[model samples]
Target: MFFHFILIFLLISNSIQNIFKYNLFHHSHPSEPKKPSNPIVIIPGDAGSRLRANLTGKPSTVHIFCDKTTKDYFDLWLNLELFSPLIIDCWADNMRLEFNVTTGMAQELEVVLPPSRLRTMQRSFTSSALLFPSPKLWGPNETFVITPRKNYSLSNIEDFFTDIEFPQGLEQWKSESPSLIIDPPGVKVYCIYGSEVKTPEQYIWYHNWLFPDYQPYLR
Candidate 1:
């Protein structure tokens, strides 16, 4: 009996020593885990097919949001000629909204916009739909390259929904119908319907000058 007890005590002591060594090794020489990349993303807005508009313009801007990663590698550049340093933070915030970065490294950034300064950059999408010659700066639907802020020609609308027409009794057909006409000159009213446009008045509101026959296109 005495010999058996001695053997059991020795076995228990050896097991405890092994466990302590394992914990010590774990604490002293920890494994080096790989780090993750930032979650911020950049999205370019659609620019209209308006070439010769600006010699220099950017098609897309960097929009930074946050993610669960501890890394933050957001280095967004902007056109120095168009906006002041104060506008830099606004661009950053707008990028944040575009990317939908809810948490993580992005949450640390706090961007505050000024009152008058805010209005200066604010533009209504409706007013900007009209194309202008020699515009001061690029607005919506104007091509802007991601890097170096270079200008590029606008591409045609690839989405076919821009010119879609539905059946006569369609739920929203009443507002979707366009009144086509021709004027004294060669200018004909080719109303390309849009999804948001509900009323005929709203469809042709931009070009008030209309022609005779109100021929509606199927789409």
Candidate 2:
């Protein structure tokens, strides 16, 4: 609950800051003829974008169950959105316990973890990868629920639906500089995050002091 409140506050603050920045930039540079200001790209918090596995063909089975539960169980959770919250909490607890037990044991022994436990950890990570598939464990494919389902293709969604590939994505963005968008010479990027979101202290320092004059843009 506290985290949620912090997130809401951050979002509101970020919105206000963006508005202020936009106005300031526009007014300060009135002499420059504005032919079509670069499009603003707004990336939302996790699972905000719609994704599909098959891009060119008909909709394939949306893999909601993380290779753990059966399809019937997934369908059951899809039918019970209200009950899903409780079930999700339970699943989160189970995943946490699974990680602690496996990693703690490996750390104590000072040896590599087993492949099976690694696989379990990978599966647990996917539990929160998508949002539409609710209850954390069971949900439908992004395209499966629609009646007379529209032709589900990845190409149709690729323009807007991009995944954050973690350290790799970060590294690529840094190396490539500001070219995430075309038609715009330099894309102004903002990193607005809630206080509750965990980030490395060094990374925070880089963002504030060292990285590309980000302080003014970050909220």
Candidate 1 per-residue lDDT over residues 1-219, each given as its tens digit: 999768756765666666677667755334677558679675644221111111122334332322223233333444332133333444443344332355533342234433333332322222332322112333435532211222222232222112222122222222322222223556665767778765321122112122111222212
Measured against the true structure, the TM-scores of the candidates, in listed sequence, are: 0.15, 0.17
Give the runs in model 2 whose Cα sits over 4 Å from its true position.
1-85, 88-97, 100-219
Tell me the whole-model lDDT of each prediction, alpha carbons only. 0.34, 0.34
lDDT of 1 at 102: 59
Per-candidate alpha-carbon RMSD to the true structure: 24.7, 23.9
lDDT for each residue of candidate 2 in 29-136, tens digit (9 for 90 to 100): 658776867798876533211211211221222233323433332221212221232334433422231225745642211224344434434434432333222222
Model 1 lDDT-worst window of ten: 47-56
As a whole number from 0 to 100, the lDDT of residue 41 in candidate 2 is 86
